[model samples]
Target: MSSSIISDATSKVKNMVAGEKGRKVADLDSVSQTVSPDDRITSDFGVKMGNVDEWLRVANEKKTGPMLLEDSFSRERIHRFDHERIPERVVHARGAGAFGNFRLFESIEDLTTAGVLTDTSRETPVFVRFSTVQGSRGSADTVRDVRGFAVKFYTQEGNWDIVGNNIPVFFIQDSIKFPDIIHAVKPEPHNEVPQAQSAHNNFWDFVFMHTEATHMFMWTMSDRAIPRSYRMMQGFGVNTFVLVNQKGERHFVKFHWTPELGVHSFVWDEALKLAGQDPDFHRKDLYEAIDNGAFPKWKFGIQVIPESKEHDFEFDILDATKIWPEDLVPVRYIGELELNKNVDEYFPQTEQVAFCTSHMVPGIAHSDDPLLQGRSFSYFDTQLSRLGINWQELPINKPVCPVMNFNRDGQGRHTITKGQVNYWPNRFEARPPATAQEGAYPEPPFNIQGIKARTKSDKFREHYNQAQLFFNSLSEPEKNHLAAAFSFELDHCEDPIVYERMSQRLADIDLGLAQTVAEMVGGTKPEKQTRANHGKKASKISQVEFAPAKPTIASRRIAIIIADGFDNTAYSTVKATIKAASALPFTIGPRRSEVFPAGASKKPGNGVQPDHHLEGMRSTMFDAIFVPGGAESIKTLAKSGRALHWLREAFGHLKAIGGTGEAVELFKLAFALPDLRVSATDEAIESYGVVTLSKVSPESLRESITIAKEGVGFLEKFLYQISQHKNFDRELAGLNSQVAY
Candidate 1:
């Protein structure tokens, strides 16, 4: 596994940047491949490292742990490549981006003077990027990883970037060790294995060694890392930031984005399959939903800790890895945000959209978290290096409001700044005037202490309590997902040492969690946990608790499969009924259009339009499948393996499958089903995703329509069930003969 992963990791770099850098840079196991994957392997100067593995292996054995003078290729490559790549951000590097906007509801005059949140009418454009911290850009989205949920609000005042993630806490206390944690989590340099993931030896070794990552690892292994949709996941500003009110009173605040639809995640099985089926799944879903008019929304909330009580909590407010239980610090919802737009161009809008922790408006500012301070300096500098010093001038990074400043001129300066004088004290009063009022732009008056030295806060030492809290809070299935996630990641580790170390760390958080993981990972579990005060628990942290009290099929898709010589009216009614319920229905048949001839002439289609033909659609693509009544069509469909295969796939996916008319005969013939739940009338596919419609009322699309409109019985029962994502537990029944497509 290590060897294969190492080769794969090397190949990724080959794919990303061979041509752009002029030389073929090989030592890089980086994720961003600028060049094509299939492009010929080349060196920094376009030379090939033919049979690289054998060569390196042979040389290493020859040296026997020491560098030999004769191996110039290995020496030169590792040496130069050591300085080839710059440092990745302290957090949130492996992320995907999209363009959107945030419209305000009501002004929050009581909280802060931040223009973006205070203005009720302005529609500030934004580019939101969601990411995984431990993985590279090439990693799977399903990996149990912290999702970076950073949004840059191009407000009228300036750009206010709320850099956050799905998980509330972070891995470390201070910025001093930020580099160390990142280095440990990133692909190890010795062999440079493990592309786009943290289930490796070096990373686990670091976790066990440092012990600060306990809280974060718990989050990493949980289901939150494998979100069903970007729209459904919550976002949090990990650190404690400050929000100053109009009166100039400073309040230490934390930000939250509770999705209006509530939080949901993909089952681990589904997430893994999706990674292979479509690595671009989440990205595609977000884009398609935005395109199809299903705009995602979230309510903005803040938890303010008074300046006087900053030191009152048992745990430090500034610790990135610690979370203040909502029970203690209630989330006061301030405003709302809606992402109604898609990017015009991915490269210009999504790719160039830079989110810096330091991008703050006058009212909002950073805290004392060492990591955040490093971020303030890192982001702009990294952008300068990556997109040039004038990257802020780029359209996506540019502030919505006009930018006026004396600072000008740098590499890649696209705009030609006019005027002879760039200084503020110019004799010409033609320059933009500054507001004199303290409310206009006053900095919070806070005193600084001590000499400039590297020191961490004492509160940073408590890491396991929140980890325990998070683990203790999960529902049964959610906890199972976490254990499964740990197993999945660690199972990929080739080194037993790595697995052992990781297991010890896991044991520190939760012994059962560690034992379960180690059993699967082929390592010994620690007898006990090795952490300080194991802290409190909360019910609300787990997303399962947030399942909408009432389930609605608003955005769900149901497919009504049909064929020629079938009771067309029954199929049409069911289709129409689902539509009436405000759920989407697709008319699927043997072909794109299933024709119904009148009387004896009813043969092939005179002409019929299907929402999607069987070929264009699949059971995996929809929430449920229904077979309309038609004796002739039913026999034809039964004979054709495609029809049975369609239902089988739907069943395998745990989607609702219902039949009416001769369609009931097809179900009876479907003896090749496992754990079949033939509802007395209607059955909800528990493993799959919907309410199957059978016993169609041709005379009345009304009964089904009644069932549809009311979110009761099978509909609501399986609503949350289907939303659970992939049925990893499914054990399929065998086919006597393989069903043909």
Candidate 2:
């Protein structure tokens, strides 16, 4: 029986290796080629090259000298390296991308005839790129700015690109003002002092001058600007488009991508600090999630309004600066987007991929949205300068379906033609256009009568009403954060006129919000409202409405603090429990070297080594913390100022805290709250954001966290506290401010 089992295992191993070597994924990977082992260095022309590290020159054995210019290979290598870079994108220059599939949960054939949306059996491959709008390619990912969430779907019909952002609205309504807004927000050309920031004189000046930007500015000043992770924020197709059904019925639509993990953001202080500590925090977070098989996902939702009722709302449906509120037109979720694969290479995949607002399939049409109309032309035109005329020929941007066209060779063109005729009107009828019945996009039969003039509708005149609605919908903590964000931005604007004017504009939204910001920024507080607020609120505008369907610690980071003479049982049990819940557990000690347990003998290999030291990481880097008990360990931690500060900072940030045995006393000493509830005499107790257990044994520590209505255990309660994200009550009760870091 043992010999038969070994033979079967050996056969299985051989089969696995064979499968790994023959796997063929998407068409992009099928076309990919790699350098072979045992191959020598060769030039672009495939000629074998020698001494690639140094130029072929006349030199002595003892000393090197460059006296000859006959080294063609060395010159060629240097010449290619000099021209290796192409022009970076003017906007959304810094980004990361991934490959995913879109699966339609419910067919929307009634709304559109698009195959990708109507076919539930087909999985449409997609490429998504997340970016920051204003930053250059070298900018930090944690800067306060608008994030770009652009997606390109490779469908059976054609390529459909959803050029969107994290925010639903934009700063300007007319596309003619695109250059103006971009130039104003970019580093001021005169000095170029601020790198990837909106808190500058020119930016504030533009905000106060352009009345249409009031609504968008309110969103930028909110916590949405500093998202916790790209996987945790919402995505919106900022521009409105038209969707036509099989019966030629038209409806105005806005696209939305709601993350499964829910919308979350970092504190302003934490965001700023992260920029210095981890410039690529967002990029690393996304790559690591996919690498660990924790695929990120979002629900595809669309807000639709019949074409007959386009003018029924106060704001124009075609205005890019306005949003069709969910209260008026509810979002219909019909599909799921899951990113399961990371890019194989950054240059040929992530950086080279392009998205055009005009690219669409049948049943999808562009609205006369002024910004979108201009973008349709601008996106294609800019690609010519950045990627040359044959940009679409690049493997990353090519569609999976066959593309046959008469438009022939430009610079860097890869396709080879065999036919003599290259024009569309050739007698051979080569590359003929497809009929409407053959998956071709048919233009809508709509007549135009208006004169060609650069103007906007009268409905665009109103801007502050919805802005007021957004401000009023925010919860108390959200409102306070908004006020603080505005004050922070205005304080950075040294120009007195710029900040003073912005402060006065805030009164149009809410009097209290304006007063709060004005006081913090040292501006003159306005005595009256600039306009009536109209007192309105909209659901789903606040981030609090996006909590996950089920509470989970999956992908969460929990830190375990320890030192010499730590409780080995508690330490090992907590780590095992955290891993079983799919959460990551990290050990932090006074030193990275191994430290002996309380009951362990003083031997070489009988100790635990921590992942990091006390000074190596901060409380802000984790979601929660756990401290195990041992008399010597607790005594040492109580006296160490850095260890004490870690507890205070975590408590002030409203993160979950857990302790056992004498560790509960260490927490009390750090917060100096003797009156706070703890497990001094009982088995377990929880108070504020802290959970403690005085007497811990292997049996009690082995207890599982089960979610139930009654008789909940201490472990279950601790995990629930982490799922809540934050404890606002700690700040409301004047507890966080009392504790110092």
Candidate 3:
């Protein structure tokens, strides 16, 4: 070939590559079905129907008669509608999912040979499901419960699933008692009063009785249970697994996913109110983030302990309730997982996807962790009943690689195979199993010699040391929140035995915690500590310790409250600034339709549109609030009790607040916060996370905005405060309690 011919060919290939890169990969597009504009409605078997609105019936003179049994079209339609819903998962039923790609920026080939983890060139397709474990399908999203963080990676070799949770540990160490814990935490059998809460008599009773659950119970009581959003929480594979290298070396491993936005959680009051104000708060947060191109991402890391050193730890490595403390076994960052695409349809993709712990590729293998052993069997068994044996055939659960097996038809089977021989060792040597050298999973060579008895390792019996370590690692605010959480939960337990025993159990973790909760819940105060705390603190154990490497307001929702006669220039500048920073800003006014600004004509069409009205949405829905300058707007807002309450409540919640011109006075009038600094004349001031400016200038605002901690202007200070998420100084300073919302 000539040089010109090769150059033309190369140009065409380059164009093709660019097109493919721009094209969104709908992996489930092949299975997607839709109604078309050119086609008429049809029955199940593809017969077009003329009238789908009415039923075919035997008609009499001037009156309708009995429906005809021969109307198969109506019958089929009704039948399909009747079976539209499958049974929701026994747990993690309320969920939202998205599709994304997993990329390995740094390979771990020295530790594991799994192509998805060891190959830097592959962009593995992934579907991640975020869920609340204790809720039913219709339950609220902000309930205080463990969030399920299950991810399925479709690699070239096979599908690898990490069925994990936001919390690093579980309530029970063994899976055999899974049903008992679930039943206790669930609504009581007789009344079924509380829908999706763990603060009840039976739950506390179980906690006190099952002393092994101490460590995990601490996590559940913390703010981690009420995450601000699914995008801001961490994920952990609770059970330990084995990683086998190409050289045949083995290591015990646990998986971790650190969010790019950092770990953050809602205050208890915010969480409780959001449950009613917006039941789908987290779900909407996720969908809108992806829709707006602010994709959620997490860094994938693993903590590995060499096989020879597994038995060197004080606690059993296989214990599900314990954590391999970051100080002892640091997590090695490896790759990244990002959710870049929203699900096309909820039912076919999010709801039908399934994950099993037994599903492994070549480099990963399950450990002898008792919880994992039972889960390996339990997950696949549940899918058999929920999705049938052919659940693997579902588009969302199917692998990117080829699958060949003797497993054949069951209910809902979609595969059509050819050939007479169906079993292994066929005459033509068809579908032979891959050898060890061919990237097949080879079980690590290890011997197990033990009696077949129901028992745990000796170290499993010693559970309080790590529990105490966790309590010692918390910050003062976190500890107080945990104590308040325990007090509230135990107070709900009217049964004296439940509250009393649990209060005493707290002494095993921390003496101060036991006394605090005991006094609040009417339990006998422990005179002495049950177990001495080791005072061993671990890094990355507290939520406050996890901060984004750089300050960012990306994807955060800010509410700009405005009314008639608001400052148009200030409002427009603030809105534009928020958008440029990649944050969401909503115009909220007295009415959702339109609100005219000062000096504007009183024409109906000459006004700014608001996304929501003050009466319809509360301040709890937003991460921050801003009020632009306008004399009439401030006066009108001062008269509205709800508007004043909004500011007061936001202050009490430790949220960032900003005001300009006369709006700064309105903020002070609402809260009666004389100590809060406000701008005087033409300057600006920031006090207790509240930013105020007496004058407004679009050009000055641009110059003032900076990313540094000490911002040069009001806009800069306000945005930086919002990026910090929450100002715990107010709550920790004991000032929030002084204000009545």
Stretches of candidate 1 exceeding 4 Å from the true structure: 1-99, 132-144, 187-193, 430-433, 436-440, 450-453, 525-535, 557-570, 577-677, 681-694, 703-741
Residue 534 C-alpha lDDT in model 3: 80
- Rank the candidate models, highest TM-score first: 3, 2, 1
- Over 4 Å off in model 3, which ranges? 1-26, 34-39
Tens digits of per-residue lDDT, candidate 1, 1-741, equal: 466765654464344334333422121112234567777665567777664443243344346453456655666677877855444444565556766668777676676788787887777777798777766556666655678898998765667898888988777766667778888877788877765677777777777777778888778778788787787899998878888787777778999999876787765655666676566767776776676666777888888898778899888888888888889999888677777766655655566668788988878877887768887887777787667778887766766454556778787676665555677554443343457362346676788877876666788787677778888888776787788788888887788878877877777677788788888888886777665435567867888677554444555567777777777666666566565555567778777644662233644545456777776655655666777666777887888776777777655544455565567668756543454444445433332232334554434233353332234444343334443433333322323123222
* Candidate 3 per-residue C-alpha lDDT over 432-550 given as tens digits, one digit per residue, 9 for 90 to 100: 67788877788877878989988989999987887888888888888989999999888888989888898789888888999999999999999888888788888888888888998
Candidate 1 TM-score to native = 0.77
lDDT by residue for model 2 over 470-495, one digit each (tens)?
89998887898899889998999998
lDDT rank order:
3, 2, 1
TM-score (C-alpha) between model 2 and the true structure: 0.93
Better of 2 and 3 by TM-score: 3
Model 2: lDDT of residue 309: 96
